[model samples]
Target: MKKILMGVLCLSTLLCGCTKNKDIQIDDKKVGQVKLKFDHIVGAKKLVLNDGTYSNNSNETFNINILKYFVSNIKFTKTNGEVFTIPKEESFFLINASQSESLQPTLNIPEGEYQTLEFNLGVDSLTNTLPVEKRAGVLDVATNGMYWDWNSGYIHFKIEGTSAASPNASKSYKYHIGFFGGYETRTVNNNRVIKIDLTKAGISKVQENLSSDIHLMVDIGKVFDGPNSMSIATTPMVMHSGPHSDIADNYATMFTHDHTHNFQKIANNEK
Candidate 1:
């Protein structure tokens, strides 16, 4: 009877250890929410629709009448190099200068200490190929007027404004960029993968079930004054494949990490 009693106690101890390990595993996999805010500016001034003054590296003066773009495939890389990719269907976002609310986007990700944030400046090729009917979530909304064509693909980025460099009466300019083909064939994949270092902000850990907000700034000047700068006087409108690629490449250099804020919570409880 003494030996049997000892055997039962050992088994109970082993069961408790297993339960504790299982709980720890579940907690490690807990997911958290991260909110991203896109702030637009031209030089040191806030970007406003219809009228925002700014000068680029080319010495060309322009006032933006429309400024909108798409960001997709947002992911975070932990200090150890583990990547937490946001679900593709829910990852695409359109930021419009005219609409203040579209600038803030909330994303759910596995809780971890992220060292870097990565995202695509334009829609991915696969998602771009999907027909409008087959697309779901944010992609299904045609009324947003972001699409270019079903066979070609959606316009990943767009900007319309007036530049002093243009000789036209209205000084109007329009630039739209996207892939030029369907399926595996594409003339130009303007999609850019942008990585931002977050160590400065000390976003070491995103607590489980809590919400963290990351503020990013998009300098409009970089669109025209980037590595391969363009002038409205020479090429005021770029709606097709050629010059659009150069501008898209420039647009890729417009984002920077500003800061971060967090709202801590305990699992399912808010604090």
Candidate 2:
């Protein structure tokens, strides 16, 4: 009888242990939130629209009056090789430099350590061609001037400012870049897929109760000087009709992973 009681007690302990382990696994599977924070800068200086003056690689001094871009199709790769893609409806975001609320885009993902972050610098081809009803919110053409009528699609990236080096009479330069392989005919596609390895800077650790923020530095100076450099004096106006491949290649290298804040408590509003 003593031996039998002892065996029963052992079995009970094993079951309890298994239940605890299962609870832990369930907790690990819980969904967490992450925020992508974009810090726009010119070289090392913070970007201040309308007032702050900055110089590019071409030695042209300019003051940005407007800066806007789209970020979509965000995907996070876990350290264990699992990739989590945000739902299509929740992935599109417009980052306007003048708007404080548009700086950080949030995502809900399973709790894990993300080692890589990938996203499209512009609106995807399918999303851009979606019907007017489907393209609401930030993608709404009426809300923002980021969209063209019908033939041009969406403007992926736009920067407008006044530069003394510009040859224009207004001393202004505008670069409105957009082309998603064209709707009817093939055109210069400026949509770029940017992939950043987060291991070196710091991987995002998302937890159920905690929110992770991946801080990235966007150097606008690279727009003028990257793989293919351009001068404000020469190419002051880069509209949809001009060659944008060089500018696209240059802006692709603008983002760099700065660090990750993995221990931020989820705000009451965010929850």
Scored by lDDT, the top model is: 2
Model 2, position 194, has a per-residue lDDT of 98
Model 2 ranges with Cα > 4 A deviation: 1-28
Mind giving the per-residue lDDT tens digits that candidate 2 earns over 1-271? Answer: 9999999999999999776121112245698889999999998899999999999888889989999999999999988898989998999999999998899988889888889999999988898778888788999977789988866489999999999999999999999999888777888788999999999988888878777899999999999978888899989999766658788888999999999887688889888
lDDT of 1 by residue, 213-252 (tens): 8889898877788888788888888876458778877888
Model 2 steric clash pairs = none
Off by over 4 Å in 1: 1-26, 180-185, 264-271
Candidate 2 achieves a global lDDT of 0.88
Taking all chains together, the TM-score of candidate 2 against the true structure is: 0.89
Model 1 has a clash total of 0
lDDT of 2 at 143: 75
